[model samples]
Target: MATFLHRLGRGAFRRRRLTLLLWAVVLGIAGAAAAGSGSGSGDSNVTLPGIEAQKAYDVLDEKFPAANADGASARVVVRAPDGKKLADSGPRAEVRSLLADLKDSSPRVAAVADPFVARTISADGTTGYAQVTYKAKATDLTDADHNRLDDALDDARGHGLTVEASGSALAPAAEAASSEAIGFLLAALILVVTFGSFIAAGLPLLTAVVGVGLTMGAITALTAALDLNSSTSALATMLGIAVGIDYALFIVSRYRSERAAGHEASEAAARANGTAGSAVVFAGLTVVIALVGLAVVNLPILTAMGLAGAGAVVVAVLVAITLVPALLGFAPERVLGRASRKKSGQESRPKTTASKLPAAERWAAFVLRRPWQVLLFSVLGLGVIALPATKLELGLPDDSSKPTSTTERKAYDMLAESFGPGFNGPLMLVVSGGDPAATKTAVAQLDRGVKDLTDVAAVTPATYNPAGDTAMVTVVPKSSPSSEQTKDLVHSIRDRAQGVETATGAQALVSGTTAMNIDVAAKFSAAIVPYLALVVGLAFLVLILVFRSILVPLKAALGFLLSVLASLGVVVAVFQWGWFQDLFGLQTTGPVMSLMPILMVGIVFGLAMDYQVFLVTRIREAYVHGADSRTAITEGFRHSGKVVMAAALIMTGVFGGFIGGADAMIKSLGLGLAAAVIFDAFVVRMTIVPAVLALLGQRAWSLPGWIDRRLPHVDIEGEKLGAIPAPSEPGHRDADFTPTH
Candidate 1:
């Protein structure tokens, strides 16, 4: 591997122009393909095959087309001023006018039902909502369509009526682009400080942008074929930008270090690519494996997200190894500042004793000074932070979780206040598999059984399809959608469904927005154990190959688990328990997103392994090169800690920017990922890992002879680089390079 990378790196250096041109061509092709493909249709709705909720949902979409068309809907909620009733002549006239304008003003508005006609008016007559169905999804809605609705809403407000809109047709505009920009700005700033040169700092950012752009373009082009959800690209973008910059940073930093060591530009680039680039590839593949492992969950959206993210990591690795060296070739010694630039044999290099070591190395020495104390403290502290994970609850985001200022939240509050909390999340009971008459009979019986349940708010009469082969009964629960009581109500209805099915020889299935969410949560929860096993287990084997030690990989996996658990605990505390909710701009607290844990596990596990591989590979390299275990730890920290810390901070900053986003799911995801980077990079990788490795000493790098013989040798330590002589070496013609102790 090292030999191949060494040759490739040197070739790229000599052929820098061609390498750059090839990347440019790749970028241009990807962009053109993405642009020509046009916008794709993506559904955010969850679809789980074989689940009862999915079966019921599919049946409805197939059999009850009118009720389940491929269009979005909105609830135009209206409320009169205090002491006034919408039913009164003046307010009623305004309400009717608003509804008429919504129906007539925009071609996008397929239909709008009158509140009074649909019986959506509250009993008190102060609040009512007209149901408006649009011909297209929110993403498909044009600006004119939005303007038409906004005009009507403004008119209603002018008439002394409080008006708001909610539902799929009125989906909030995404602010992720702004958040991403913020992340880029912050990343650039961090890079400038780390690299200490404008040209050097911009290189990683450029590579990151190119890599992420290519990944996104590919995702856009593949969206329709893969049936990717609208939000899938967000995950891919976040991971790509972060890892892209990070991978480039690692290689660039290594190249500069080699330049400082008095190697000429070509050899430096080659050696850097052979060494740091090797670790970059190994680290990147672990991330890829963990991300692609999302397939174990059997969720299409998650699978797409994982695959897309993995694609980004792959691009990052390739760019780091190929593009970085090529770009460095363009700059040469200019990549190093005057103080850092070294010519062969210009000066004798001082021995790197403890006192002369950098702060990063000193920190490593301090941690190793009392390995047991550092290990115990880190574990205990992380254990304390992980306590909140025990109380983790999962659910999909609902209107109540939106900001109070959002129209969705306002509509939700008004609806819950006027109609009942249950109105927001009514459960649907689908009865089929019998004669029309028998189906109707079964539906009625099921409705009666459901109404008798403790939390049942109301059960609508059976509504049959045109053929009457299937019937649906809407069962509104007494509690809110995210409440435990509502979940219990769903379970109770499904439980009673068994009896109804047996008695009438019919199939009774429970489904609805609420029920589907419940099922999605359950599915995500059930997949966690297996997903962890697959990701952790696979990553463990890869780490063993990289470090060539059983205990090292085991330690890496365990540390990753700790960081992930601790991050999840923090997410739960802030997003669910509402701890410092205001600080994060959360308006409400509920169950953590159903997909958060598994999503976090995959993402954080991959990222955790990133730090693990980069940090441990360095330690292993030093050990392999004849440094004692303790010296190796310090040497590894001295060479790699600044770059690793910089990478972690960049990732943390990028992810942290997303915490301020409007989307609750994105916010939670950002916090979870950012927290994981902090815990894993700073705490686990920096502190606990060195401590444990110090304790293990020579055993840390041990590989069983039998196993070692069978395993394919991965030359991550760049042993092959020895053939390429350095000027500093005794046999080299220059012979000016000084060796540090």
Candidate 2:
């Protein structure tokens, strides 16, 4: 592998212009393709094929087509400002005129129901709502369609009534692009400070942009055939930028170090590519494998998100090895800028032994002196953070979770104020495939049973379809859609409706936004164990191959688990338990989004492996050269600690920027990832790992001879850079370092 990388690096240097030109061409093509194939925000529906709830949902749609059409329904709310009754002649006439105008506005407008005929006026007579159904789903609606609705509502706002339109079809404000821009700016600042070179800092950002651009294009094109959610591209961009910068930063920093050590430009670039670049490849694989392991859950949205993120990582890795090296070859010395040159000159002069060891190395020595204390402290701290994970709840965020500034949120609030909180998400009961009379009687009985249940606000009479086999009942809950009481109400209704099914021989199925969310949460919860096992187990096997040590892989797996749990616990506390909710601008508290756990597990685990591979590989390389475990630990920390800290900080900032987005889900995801990176890099990688290795001593690197011999040789630590000389040889540095094996 080292030989192949060396050849590739040397070739890239020899053909630097050609390599740059090739990447330029690829970038142009990707940009054009992405522009031509505009992006899509995925459908809001969470479909789980083969699940009982899904089957019930499908049956309800089939039997009661009017209630579950392909289109979306919006509510146009009207309020009287002067305390005038909305049922009065002036306000009522204006609302009627608006509804009539909206119904005739566009071909996309399927129908608009009258507030008077539908009895949608509030009991206080100061507020009322009109229903507007479109011909397409919310995600499928065109901009022009939304514009027409906006125009009609604008014209309808007069005559003592204020009109506001809100519905699923009206898209929420997208803050992802702005958030990414902020993240990039912050990353650039961090990079410049870390590298002390504008050119060096710019290169990683450029590589990340190119990789993300190409991957987003491919993801956009993929939407033509696959059902990708709207947030998938944003997520892909986030992961892509982070890994791209980190990967290139690693190689570039190594190249500078080699150059500073007096190696020629080409030799320095080649060696860096052969060493840190190799680690980058292994790290990229860990991330991709963990991401792709989302397929184990068999959920389409998650699968799409995982694959999209994995694709970005793959591109980032490729660019790191190919484009980054070629760019470095173009201007090897100048890439590090003036500050680096001054530092290199200072290093060239003779130095004392104390100055040779950096602060990180000294800290390593300090930790080793009290390994047991550091280990116990880190474990206890992580355990405390992980406590809240035991009470973690999972569910999809509803419309009410949107920012208050959004029209959807405003509409939700207005409806809840007027009609009750349950108005936002009402449950539908479908009784199908039975005698018309029998179904009606069964529906009536079920309605009576549900209306009497706790947490139920109202139950409407059964409304049968034109076909005698189908009937529907709408149940409204007193609590909010995302509340535990609402979810319990849904389950209770489904369970009790079975009695009516037995008597009337008509199947009763619960189908609505609340029920669908319940099903999604349940499905994700059931799949969590398998998803974790698959990702962790696969990561374990890969690490074993790379590190060639059983204990190393075991330790890495356990550390990753701890980091993920701790991160999740933080999310549960902030987003679910409502601790410091005001700080994050959260209007309400609910369960953590159902998909957060698995998604965080995959991303955090991969990232944990990323640091582990970079840090441990250095230690292993030193150990293989006959340094004792203790010396290797200190040496490895000296070599990689600063870089790891910079990388982790940059990643944390990038992820933290997403918390400013309008969506609560995105905020939770950002917080969790950022928290995980900080803990893994600082606490786990720096403290626990070194402490564990110190205790393990020589056993840390042990592997069965037969298993080691059979395993594929992986050289991530650049052992093949040159042979190690004997410790007794003249000018040998190994003897200067104390051995504690």
lDDT of candidate 1 over 477-554, digit per residue (tens): 889888889998888888888987888888889998899888988888888998888888888989888888999999
Local distance difference test, per candidate?
0.86, 0.82
TM-scores, one per candidate: 0.96, 0.92
lDDT of 2 by residue, 254-340 (tens): 888878877666667777888888899999999999999998888888888899999999999999888888888767767877877
Model 1 regions more than 4 Å off: 174-177, 342-356, 725-741
Candidate RMSDs in Å, in order, are: 3.1, 5.4
What lDDT does model 2 reach? 0.82
- Residue 218, candidate 2: Cα error in Å is 1.0
